[model samples]
Target: MSELGIHYRRGPATVTGSPRPRQGPHAGDRLPDTPAGLQRRVAGPGYHLLFGGPTRSWPQDPPLGGRGDLVSVHHLGTQSPWPGITHALVRPDGYVGYLARGTDLTGLRAYLDRWLPAR
Candidate 1:
């Protein structure tokens, strides 16, 4: 079974259940076999996980942390209301998923200069 779960934060339109089983990152994909691997996938370029609006699932993981261009939401330790908000790929339902702060990939690409370069 999938180890993922929707994080229930204190807010309206709360995340209900695990995202209906889809393609890509499955339960046992094993992409993030280690911390560094996770780091790469989360912050890798050409990828941004967006939530809300018509689009449901993100085709790719979000970007990682940054100082000037890419603002690391996780690093900031805060939360912003969603509409076009995205975040770093730190596991869909991991502990950080429930955290108040993290990265937003859509914002990163739109504002930041970071781009997903093939690795």
Candidate 2:
């Protein structure tokens, strides 16, 4: 599997337990393993926000700041597994909760508010 593109998504399972053709990273799909150091960093509690490359600007207050302990951020430089993707939010369960191909974080903020609303 490692030989395949990191963005590859397994086909979804059908009601009869057969796999259905699909594409792209969907919510609940298991995140492919990142580099060892990054994997270790996210092995604990909290949702992890991974930046694929150097960002020009980032929010002064990250989403879900009220639950800071439950959120952490990491920069993967150019070695990010998700080629062409700018950001990837991995949930605590090791699934991809969100993904962004551009620098705009509006969608990311909305996703956080909907799922991990700040208290």
Candidate 3:
């Protein structure tokens, strides 16, 4: 990536329960049985990233724009080195990006209509 560089390239990501459980009776199961525990669990980074395969969710947050809309689904990762694979770039200021074939980028189109220069 031009900004974060290859280090941030973790690959297509997914979300999952946290690694550590607070212990107690309800540990080892879904994040937390109690509302408070759930809060704490989500308070921290809790997503598993996956690279190439079928469509999946981002482990962390999806690439975000300055105004708060998901910008792109593809990002640089170990599995996506050398500008390889399908990719897209979103701008915080609302810039149009290239969308690879097979991806449903309806959200991007909506954003462009509302934010991009002409829109």
Candidate 4:
């Protein structure tokens, strides 16, 4: 934000102890997908999942309400926003909640589980 000339309250007086800001994707950032591709991926109401690398498989949907409300998985190729990441869970709000550089479904599950209850 600072680099973009958007400034906010700075220094120790600002609220502290929050988790470090992640760089994968911001709340309002665009999904790194073509219009048609994104249309196909997020055809329903849910997350727009993207995975890099040669993996065609995705983890089983977690305990969310329905597949449509959980995630719409897609295979991201070389055009991936985060080149090294194997998987990323883009929330409906457009923020990337989780990203994995390797095939770690368990870790991804844990990360998503931590946020599901809050949602």
* Superposition error at 1 for model 4 (Å): 10
TM-score of 4: 0.54
lDDT of candidate 1 over 1-119, digit per residue (tens): 54343333333212212322222223222223232344443454332232332233333334433432322223211221222222332233232222112233343343233333223
Point out where model 1 deviates above 4 Å. 1-17, 32-119
Which prediction has the highest lDDT against the true structure?
2
Give me candidate 2's TM-score against the actual structure. 0.66
Q: Write the per-residue lDDT of candidate 4 for residues 83-105, one digit (tens) a residue.
A: 45466666665445555566656
Model 3 segments more than 4 A misplaced: 1-88, 92-102, 117-119
For candidate 3, the 10 contiguous residues with the lowest summed lDDT are: 12-21
List model 2 lDDT by residue over 1-119, tens digit each: 65323432342310111121133444445665655466676788888887765554445455554767777887676656655436777878676767666566776677677778787
Deviation of model 1 at 2, angstroms:
21
Taken over the whole model, the C-alpha lDDT of each candidate is 0.30, 0.61, 0.28, 0.51
Candidate 3 per-residue lDDT over residues 1-119, each given as its tens digit: 34222222222221112221122212112222233442232232322111222335233454333422323333334233112223233232121122232234354344344544231
Worst 10 residues of 1 by lDDT: 75-84
TM-score per prediction, in order, is: 0.19, 0.66, 0.21, 0.54
lDDT of 4: 0.51
Winner by lDDT between candidate 4 and candidate 1: 4
